[model samples]
Target chain A: MMHLPNHWPYIAAAYGLTIGCSLVLGIGAALRLRRAKTRLAAVESQLRHRESSAS
Target chain B: MRPTPYLLHRYANPGQFLRLARALQPWLSTGAIIFLTVGIVWGLFFAPADWQQGETVRIMYVHVPMAWLASSCYLGLAICGLLSLVWRHPLADLAAIEIGPVGACAAALCLITGSLWGQPMWGTWWVWDARLTSVLVLFFLYLGHIALIRAFDEPARGQRAAAILALAGAIDLPIIKFSVQWWNTLHQPDSITLTGAPTMSMTMLWPLLITTIGFTLGVAAVIFARLSAAIHESRTRQLMARSRLNRSDRSAA
Candidate 1:
């Protein structure tokens, strides 16, 4: 196995930052999508209820 | 055969785009995770250390791809801006808006990682080099877009203003690309070239390429997911407004 360099901390920091930022952005986008879908569903269901009562 | 206007219109429709995004999201997100895992492992452990830079070379894996996406995303935003302005394509505006935050995030990553890499190599954490400065500008442009988009009372007006800003900011892309060649800078020139073979060896090159592909897929997935959310939000607002109108009409009757 190749020996790890003394500068391993730098390597770890770089990867950590990259992965950290990526996870934040990815999770944030997912949450936004979920919220939007929930809102849309609620609005749609209310519309359906109104239409049925009107009929 | 060229796509007809009807085909373009159909593809640009939010409902059609949402359907396409739903179909592609799973595959894109999964592929991004797989490729990123494989590439990062290979880059960090298996790839040979640079003879000069030693272990610090590992920073290139993340920094390079982030830098690539930072610029590429802006290019995409500019194209979407043009489409929105000239063709009045609502989907283009939506894409531009969604891309702003993602591109800014990528650009910010690039700067941070670049600084980390530079401190050990260049003996300084930051510099006013053309390449670095232009990237900073790119990040600010993204922030400007995000701020402009939310600045107006009417969303349509905000979109129009942001689209114009996106188009104007595109002038920075080429400057960022050719900065090293054009200026005397501590930053090195491009390792990968369009017209000739890459300067990097295969072991280093392969991981970089794989990581780039993974990052690209990840960016695409995020953009699509955000676009879907934006479309849904727009639809919900429209529905709420219509419902209010209907209620007022019934009361009047």
Candidate 2:
């Protein structure tokens, strides 16, 4: 086979950065979703409390 | 009346949309990771070096995708903004706000990576090429939308103002896409253009395309995830307001 350019390091760097950033973003978003779910649950429970008290 | 945009309608309902986003995010993120990994491995080690640019040409893998995404992010913003403006969809407004920061980050990444690539090739960290200038404008536009969205005291007013700004700035998208061909600019010709064929070989082209898809899906996952958070936050705020109103009424009684 013919010689390919020895740019493996740069290639690794670029792809690695992409992966790292994407992973951080994905994970961060997931965590946010979980937090939002929790907050929503709290609000729902509070609403239930108010409704039950009124009834 | 024209038929509704099917994809939009299919995913329009907030509960359904949340379910779909939850299902798709993991798979899309995985696809992004897999394709980007394989594409990079193949492009770096397997593909032959360019005749003219030699190793430096490898930067195209990162540069081209970033360049494409930098503007494409704006397009995403505009689409979501239009949906918010025309139909006043709550999800659309949420999407508009959610996508702003992500698009801004993507544009910033593009500029930084492009500058790094340019430093090696173009002999400077910066250039006034048409593509570069338009992309800079795009970055500013993303920032402007983000700021404008948060500027107003009323959330609805802020969203409407941001929607108008987003629609207005969409004009730059086409200018950025065609700037290479239109002007006497230093930016290289588009590897991917509106016309028939690409200038690059199959070996080089496939990886680029795959990575582009990967990047795009990756963007979608991020936007969806962020939008979920925004919607939840909005719901919480509404709950808080109702509770506050109740407390005030009780105290007055």
Native contacts recovered, each model: 0.81, 0.50
Tell me the tens digit of each residue's lDDT in model 1 across B83-107. Answer: 8888888799889889998999999
Measured against the true two-chain complex, the DockQ scores of the candidates, in the order shown, are 0.68, 0.47
For every model in order, what is the number of clashing pairs? 0, 0
Which candidate number maximizes TM-score? 1
lDDT of each: 0.93, 0.80
Superposed on all Cα atoms, model 2 deviates from the true structure by an RMSD in Å of: 3.0
Tens digit per residue, CA lDDT, model 2, B1-253? 5468766676677888889888988898788778878876776677767886677677677667777777777887788789988877768778888888878877877787677566656778798989899999999999999999999899899999999889999999989888988998888877776767988898899877877887787888788888878778878989999989988998999
Worst 10 residues of 1 chain A by lDDT: A1-10
Question: How well is each residue in A1-55 modelled by candidate 2, as lDDT tens digits?
Answer: 4554454455556556655666777788889988998999999898999889988
A1-55 in candidate 1: lDDT tens per residue?
4554477777789899899989988899999999999999999999999989998
Docking class of 1: medium
TM-score of 2: 0.88
